[model samples]
Target: MKNYDVIIIGTGAANIVADAAIADHKSVAIIERGKFGGTCLNRGCIPTKILVTAANRIREIREAAHLGIHVESVHADWAAVSRRMWHKVNENDSIRTYYEQFKNVTVYAGTASFVDKKTVRITDANNHTEEITGTAIIIATGGRTHVPSVAGLQESGYITSETFFGAAYPPEPYKSLIIIGGGPIGCEFAHVFNAFGTHVTLVQHNIRLLPKEDESVSAYMLQQFEDYRIQVHLNQDTLSVRTENGEKILTCSDRTNGKK
Candidate 1:
């Protein structure tokens, strides 16, 4: 069994610090279960920010017309935007390359699970196992998408932010979009799609949207979303969802009015 001085289990901003150990010529090992770059580059921040920036630009253009600046309408191309973001995110050729080229670093792609306090078992994609021991271990499996227990939603073929990347833009003008959550992801998605000519309906389970943030900020965001022509539904319970013909329809009960 080969051993090392350090073992880092994630590949994010923290990796820079971990690589520093290699720079010092200390024996180093890193493991990743998925892409070389973690959630921020591969899944979370980068691509979403691209869409947000696009949305913001669209907003600026539309407002410019009202500001006495005549400008033609522009369209969003999700595929192109997604591709551009992915290219930049994957610029680092390989984590293995980083480890190999470094003075004394090694990288393995696998799942690292604790077998004991200072020891870990790494199971690779093919289920091959390696027992690794390190003086220090770091666990940095970041955030994951949380799916709500809405009726029939699982089978409804709906898309999460992960799925949204490969999802094609609606060819027909999206007359309406019913976003189930009003958290940051939901708000950002609402803004993006709405800016891209989709009429948006934002539903939140809480009394006010963005309940996780400051109350004033939530109220301000609500007004901003409304100004962007998004319909805000607060304190609504998602009862059921069904596919009619090809479109997804959500059955919801308004907590405040008891109306569906």
Candidate 2:
């Protein structure tokens, strides 16, 4: 068992604080389960924003014709986008190289679970086990998308924001997309797919889109969604979903209008 002055679990915004701790000459060890730079850099912000930017460029070129400016067809290549995202991710975060360069910090790529108050065990990539005893531990594991409970949802194949980022664009252009939640992730993806020529239908349990945001912000976004002709099913509950002849049929009940 090795010992350290401080151990940090996540490496996103908390890493900034840890850097400050290191500058104070406190011996530190960081154990990350996945990539460094945490969720924001690895899965959440970076890749999504990359896709959004590409999608927006395509949209702009498409609208140029309506402004009396004739433009050639807009194209988006999935493989090229994926390669660029991967390259940027690698350049921004290389954990192995960091450990080699930093003498004070010991990096272990593993699942770290607490055995007790002062001790933690990490199961590394090669199934190796390492134990560390730290005087202080900071847990910065961020939030994950909450896939709500709906009938027959678990067995049905679906994608969350994390998986969606890595997913290759559909081989053929899809005519329409039905997104389950009208929250940030869902709405953002709706915009991306819509820009790429897919009609989008956003379903929300709340009366307004982006329920958790400030009411005024939500109202503004709802108006934008309406302007974009993104179909919304507000205050509706999904009763069931069944795949029929390779198409998913969702049965929903509208709570506000008393329609099923």
Candidate 3:
């Protein structure tokens, strides 16, 4: 049994915090299930926000005509942008490389599960497992995308922030998009895709876009979405989703009118 002074499960910012603050005499074994730098670095905010930046740039150039700038032929090279952004901060190549130089830090690339209070079992992709015993263990595993249970929603095909930003990057342009939620993430996607010339429709279960925020903000944001011709549906309880003839359809019940 290999023993360590401290064991951290997950490679996110929380693990970084635990790593940096440990006593100088202590050794650390960080167990990473996937990327070394966690979701914000590899999937969550960083990559998605880069796409947002590109979207913002595209929007600016498109609106440049109104300012008499006369910019011509503005286009988004998503494939190139993804390659540059991901490769620049890739965990194996860049961000996580810094820890490899530290003699006190050892990183394990596999999923870690608590065998008991003081021991963790790490299993790699090949199913080989190693048990590490530690005096102290910290769990910092991150989150996953929430997929609501609407009938046929999963089978019909839907893209959330995780899949669109984290997993799959469609090489070709997406002609139309129907965003399920109307919170910040959904709103951001509406803006980004609409700017990139995709028809965007936002379905909000709440009465307003940002239901948690002040009504004024929701109203203003709703106006902004409409300005870009982004369709907004409020208080729409999406009952189910289905595909027919290559078109995905949302069967929804209108909260305002009780019609489906």
Candidate 4:
């Protein structure tokens, strides 16, 4: 059993804590189940923003007429965009290599389970396991996507924010999309895909999109979506999802009127 001064679970925000501990001459152990940079670097903010940047350029080109700049054509090469995004975001190995240079830091690439208040067992990709103890344990594991309990959703197949930039990412923009949420993630995807010429249908259980935001902001977003021809269905509760004859179908209920 190896021991350290600090055991940090997750490579996300916990990285900051690990650095601090190492700087203080304390031995540090980091357990990461996935890539080194965590969600933001691997599947979240950085990658998503790369796509968003392309989407923004497309929007600017389309709206350039308002500035009296008549552009003949605007083409979004999804292959090129994806290549660039992956090239920029695929730094996991580099991150791990950097951490390995530190003599006092032990990087465990695996899932960790608590054995006690100050001990954890880590199981790596090959099913190898090791027990490590620490004077203190820091849990900086990030949040995950909350899949709603809709019937046949799993069987129908779906991708959450985590998988959107992962192996499940489509080679190109989908022809059409049925987004089942009205929160930030759903709205952002709707905007990006719509800008890329995908017909988007957004279903929200709440009466308005961005329910957590101020009502005025939600109204403004809805108006913008309308202007962009993104179909917005508010007060909708997704009841089921199924693949029918090679087509993905979603059944939702009108929350206000109880209509299907």
Cα error, residue 19 of model 3, in Å, equals: 3.8
Candidate 3 regions with alpha-carbon error over 4 angstroms: 21-23, 65-68, 89-92
Report lDDT (CA) for all predictions: 0.79, 0.79, 0.81, 0.90
Query: Tens digit of lDDT per residue, candidate 2, span 11-58?
Result: 777787678777777778888877777777777888778878888888
Error of 2 at 83 (Å): 2.7
TM-score, candidate 4, is 0.97
Prediction 1 TM-score vs. true: 0.87
lDDT of 4 by residue, 1-260 (tens): 89899999988777889889989999999888888888888888888889899999999998999999999999999899999989977787898888889999998889999888878999999999999999999998888998999999989899887887777899989999999889988998999899888999999989999999999999999999999999999999899998988888998999878899
**Per-residue error (Å), model 4, residue 81:** 1.2
Off by over 4 Å in 4: none
TM-score quality measure for candidate 3:
0.90
Task: Report the error of model 3 at residue 32, Å.
Answer: 0.8
Say which prediction, candidate 1 or candidate 3, comes out ahead on lDDT: 3
Top model by lDDT, which number? 4
- C-alpha TM-scores of all predictions: 0.87, 0.87, 0.90, 0.97
Ranked candidates, highest TM-score first: 4, 3, 1, 2
- Residue 63 C-alpha lDDT in model 2: 78
